[model samples]
Target: MPAPFTADTVTVHSPATSANLGPGYDSFGLALSRYDRVRARVRSAGLNVRVSGAGADELALDEAHLVVRAMRAAFDRIGAQPPGLELDCHNDIPHGRGMGSSAAAIVSGIELARSLSDDGRARLSDAEALALATELEGHPDNVAACLLGGLSISWLADGRGAAARAATAEQLAATGIRPVLFIPAEQSATRAARALLPEQVPHADAAFNAGRAGLLVLALTSRPDLLLTATEDRLHQGYRAAAMPASAALITALRSRGMAAVISGAGSSVLALALADQAGAAAELTPVGWECARLEVSSGARTSGA
Candidate 1:
């Protein structure tokens, strides 16, 4: 039997995320302070969606909307689809700028659906929620961070998504590191950026990345001083640099000044893991047209009004 929804309305806030932080490749992720908020209400009859901020002009307001699609998937798992839905999305995350905008939308939808059902939480454990989100997003990194928050390391176990937070909320606060993003006005598609990589990398490069990835975890948690060295990569960044030259140049410039910077996710936006003292300088290095923001490491998604 389908689980009946216990609530008429639910709201969820999902944070933006950056994945593949330096050498961690498809494993590392960090949630940012910015977020997208979605409020969904069960209705008696059809679908209604309203959008504002960021992708307001481009996003669909129908069943084709990513959030709606995610809700549909979750409802299917719960064995009941609402007769109708009303969704209002207020977004802060920029679309296609290498921030996990899509992941935020997907997570928000799933969380909202869970919040609406009487037994949704029981039916969808945290692991099950992560697995479903990963199936929808096609990777675990960004979605993991969006769900679990702070710094998360995610991987597949038996072909299902699994993740753990590397630092507690308190531990992350004590690190005194801020995430500074340099976002270009232009956008880069994840697919297009991915197409630039060679199918095979040299064994030497692979070995080099493994060592740095290990060091990166240590640096992010307890040793901010090692970040400049720890964030070095021999994997994806260099190969995709040509497609986002400005981002590539900015990262190089920031690193030369002793800051740890990398391409955020696929391309276009650059992320600098900056200590309190370095945050301002990191922002100053942003190119004329790019947007810069200094953000704290964020907590995971939250739902209310179920």
Candidate 2:
């Protein structure tokens, strides 16, 4: 008879992530339509990796890769050597495009580790798994939205994920939120984008962001009708504009069209939209310098096709 689970492989699906949700800066984020895949199967006693898709041409599918690093760390947590392994990947999310491609890999890799702990099965509590995954991914924005689906408000401590302080799927579900993604043919280096900002902002700028930040939460939660009012940002967007070649043009175009958009995390990809009816035609605009993809916001990042 064939074994019920002979493969001894754990295939984890991770959704693509968009961090720094326009006004949220380090505080806000959303999952997106893109994705990547990771399949881990056990072998005798060595490690092997394979890669294909979006970033494959540039990414290392070996020990030096970020996913590999997270997997190894998970093994260390369990105090065991992961059996020889095969990791097959498909990278739908482009690298360095301000999308959470790397974070998804980290979360998927951690799931692989957790599976190894349960004698090759995944049995970690959702909360525990969430915390562990966030630690491996560094920060809660991407990991939180991916794990729980929908909108998540999480806190991280010492590089570990805290239980969601609050989750907003209920609120987000009450109304529809569509996303307009201006994916340029060119990708932005997250690190370079970060380098564009000053280590500190003037007090006035910081204070102004605080007020809008509050409005952002309210708009997303209790009153999405105010999304237009809520989308205004003070902290990261304007500052990042100087560095991101495409920022100003995209934001202006989106607003002129009555769409709500903000930099979806230190980005070149400007995520925005008005309503579902508008999304279809809006996607067709494709400004002179950008490639646009418009998708209504789903509760969480997508993984079925990853």
Candidate lDDT values, in order: 0.91, 0.67
Q: Write the per-residue lDDT of candidate 1 for residues 1-306, one digit (tens) a residue.
A: 134875467889999899998999989999999999999888777999999999999999999999999999998987788888889999999999999999999999899888887788888888999999999999999999999999999999988989999985558769888899988999899999888889999999999999999999899899989999999998999999988888888998999999999999997899999999999988888899899989888898989887
The per-candidate count of clashes, in order, stands at 0, 2
In order of appearance, the predictions have TM-scores of: 0.98, 0.86
Q: With candidate 2 superimposed using the best TM-score fit, by how many Å does residue 135's alpha carbon deviate from the native? A: 4.4
- Local lDDT at 226 for model 2: 71
lDDT of 2 by residue, 1-306 (tens): 122123455666676666666556665666665667787766766677888988777878678777778777776655565556678887877776777777788777766766655432334555666676777666777777776655556676766776452435445646666667777777787777777787888899777767776777777666666776677776777877877756667787777777777777667777774566667766776677676776534455332221
**Stretches of candidate 1 exceeding 4 Å from the true structure:** 1-3
